[model samples]
Target: YGGIFTPTEAAGVGVMAMLAIAITQGALNWTQLKDSLLQTADTSAMIFAIILGSEVFDAFLARSQLPMKAAEWVSATGLPPFGVMALLMLFYILLGAVMDELAMILLTLPVFFPIVAALDFGLPPEETAIWFGILVLIVVGIGLTCPPIGLNVFVVSAIARDVPITAIYRGVLPFVAADIMRLALVTAFPVIALLLVRLLD
Candidate 1:
C-alpha cells in the first residue's frame, strides 16, 4: 500500500474524489448539493445528540461507581463464565429495546467490558475483547430490528410513511434471525471473530 494517506485521510480523499467526479459529470446540481448538505447537517446533529446523551449517562454511572459495583457483584455470584456471558447478552437485548446501539454500548461497556475481560475465554485478553465486541454488535443489530421500540424500525417508518411498521418489522425478521445465528457462532467459537486479526498478524 502507498503511504500517501492514512486510512482516515483516505476516506476524506475518496469523498473529495467523488465530489470532483460528480461536478465534472454535471451530476451535482445546486439543488441536489443543498439537499445533500442539509441532510448531512441533520444526521450530524442526531449523532452528536446521541453521543452527548450517552456521555452524560456514562459520567453519571462513573460517578456512582455502579459499573464497578455491578462487576463486583457479578464476580461474587460464582456463576460460570459462560453463564455470566449469557446473562449479559440477555441484558443487552432488553436494554437495546429502548436505547440505540451507540448509547447501549457506551452506557454499558464500563460495566460489561470488565466483567467479560475477567472471564477465562481460552484466548488472550485482546482476543476476548475483540470477540465480545463482535457479539455485542450482533445483539445490538438484533435489537434494532425487533418490534415495538426498535430505533431503526422507527427511523425507517418515518422515512417510508406509506408502509406499516408491522410490515417493516416482519421484513426484518430474517435478518434478525441471521444475526442471532451469527451471535451464537461467535459466542461458541471466538476464533471466528479473531481469525482475520490472527491472519493479518
Candidate 2:
C-alpha cells in the first residue's frame, strides 16, 4: 500500500517480526513485554528530549548569525583553503563537545559549505561536497567519543551503570586518538574518501 517504507513503518515491521519469533519460541511473556515497552519508552523520551533541546539551541545560534559571521571572518583571513578547512575542523571539535552531532552538522553546514564551495579546491563541486562530508563525519564521530560531553560515552555509561563513566572515558581515549590520526590522513589525501566514488563512476 505504501510507495516506500518509511523509518516508522520499518521499525513497526521489525517489532512485529520480533514478537512473532518470540511467540513461536514461547520465550516472551506479559512481564517481559511490559518491561521492554517501558524501556523503549524511556529511551525514546530521552532521545526526543535531547533532540528538542538541541533544536532550540541551534535556533538561538542561527538567530544570532554567529555562524555566518564566523564564516565571513575566516574568508577575510586570507588563509589558504587547507588552512581554512583545518580551522573549521578545530571549530567542529569544540562545537561537538557541547552540541549533539546531528544538531551541530545541521547548524553549521549552511555557513561552512558556502565558504568551502567558494574556495579553489580543484575538484568538481560534487566531489568536493563528498570529500568535505566525509571529513565532517570523521570529525563528528571523534567528537561523539571525545571528552567533556561525548554523547556515545554517556549513552554507554547510562546502559552499563556498573562500569564507572571515568573508566569508559579512559577506554575510549585510544580509539579517539586513532580517529584523529585517520582524520589527518583523510584530510591530506582526499582520494582516501573519493576512491570508491571514482571507481563506481
Candidate 3:
C-alpha cells in the first residue's frame, strides 16, 4: 500500500523533486530559483493590494449601520427558504452590476449573513453562509464576462482592440450558460458547496 505524508512534508519532497527535474533539464541554478521567487512575490503583492483596498471600504460599510438595517428588513420579510435564497442571489447579481465583487462581498456579507442566520433553512448557520457565498460568487462571475463594463472582457479587448466586444460576448455566451447550469445545481442542492465541509468530519 502507498503511504501518505503531511502536507508540509509532501511540499518539501515536491520542491526537492522540482530541483532534481530542473537539474535534469539543464536549468537548475540559484539564479533561476531566485528569479522565480521574485516573480511569485510580485504577483502576491498585487493581489494583496486589492484585498487591502477592498477591506478599507468593507470596514466602512459595517460601521455605517446600513448592513444591520438591511439584515433586519430581510428577517422581517419572513420569505420561504428558497425565496429568501433567490432574493439574495438577485440582490448580489444586481449589486455586481455596479459594485466590485470583492468589496460587495466584504461589505454586504456582514449584513446579509445575519439575516440568513436568523432563518430556519434546515441547515446550520455556517453551511448557509458558505452556500450563500457560492451563489454570490456565481452572480458576480457574470459581470466578469459581461460587456459594457466587464473587467475581464475589457482586459481582453485592450490587448486586441481590433476585435469587437460583441465578438467576445458572443464567444463567451456558451460558457455563461454552463456557468448558469452550475449555479442552478449548486443553488438547488447546496451540498455542492458543502461537500468538503461535510467530508472533513
Candidate 4:
C-alpha cells in the first residue's frame, strides 16, 4: 500500500502531518498558515509553468522529427559505438544546460534510447539502458551545477540572497569536477552501474 503512493502524494501527506502537528502545538497561527499557503501556491504555480513549457517544447521537437534525424545521423556516422556514445553524452550536457533535467530526459530519451539500443555495447539491452541512464543522470547533474545557467546554482543564490551568484558558481566547480570524474568512470566501466542490478536478479 505504501509503495502505491507516488512521491507527490507522499510529500502531500508529510506536509499535512507537519501542519497538524504545528496546529496542535499552537505554533502556527492564522497569519503563518496563510503565508505558508501563499508560498506553496506560488511554488506550485512555478512548477506548473515549467511543466507546461517543457510539454510545449517537447511537442515542437516531436513535430520537427529532430530526434529521428539525430538518431539517423548518429547511425550513419562511421565512429565506433563508444565514440557515438560520447557524442550523445556531450549532447546531453548541452541540452541539460538549457532545459530542466526531467524535461530533457522525457524529451530526448524516446529518440536517444532507440539509437543506443541498436549499438553493440557488449552488454544486454537492459544493461545498456541502465548504464546509459546513469551516464545521462550524471551529465545532467553536472549541467545543473555548472556555470552559465546552472539551475541549482541560481536556486541556491535565490534562497540565500546574500551569497553572490558568481560565488555560488565558483563554489559549484569542485562538485562539477567530481561529477565529470564519476561520469567518465561510469562510461568506461558498465559494471559499476550493473552491480546492484545484477545483485537484485
Name the candidate that leads on lDDT. Answer: 2
Return the lDDT, model 4, position 45: 67
Candidate 3: C-alpha lDDT = 0.71
Candidate models: Cα lDDT each: 0.77, 0.84, 0.71, 0.80
Candidate 2 displacement at residue 180 in angstroms = 1.6
On lDDT, the stronger of 1 and 4 is 4
Please report the TM-score between candidate 1 and the true structure.
Answer: 0.68
Extract clashing residue pairs from model 2: none
Clashing pairs in 1: none
Residue-wise lDDT of candidate 1 within 39-68, one digit each (tens)? 777766665665465467556755787646
Tens digits of per-residue lDDT for model 4, 95-141: 66656788778778888888888889999989999998888888988
List pairs with backbone clashes in candidate 3: none
Better candidate by TM-score, 1 or 2 = 2
| lDDT (10s digit) by residue, model 3, range 1-201 | 135878878877888898889978988788888887886676556555544654665567668866566666767778897777777776665555444676777777777776777777678878887787778788788756654455555556555568997898788778767876887788888888899989995
RMSD of each: 4.3, 3.3, 6.3, 3.0
True-vs-predicted CA distance for residue 148, candidate 2, Å: 0.8
Candidate 3 C-alpha RMSD relative to the actual structure: 6.3
Which segments of candidate 2 are over 4 A away from where they belong?
1-15
Candidates sorted by TM-score, descending order? Answer: 2, 4, 1, 3
Q: TM per model?
A: 0.68, 0.83, 0.61, 0.80
Candidate 2 lands at a TM-score of 0.83
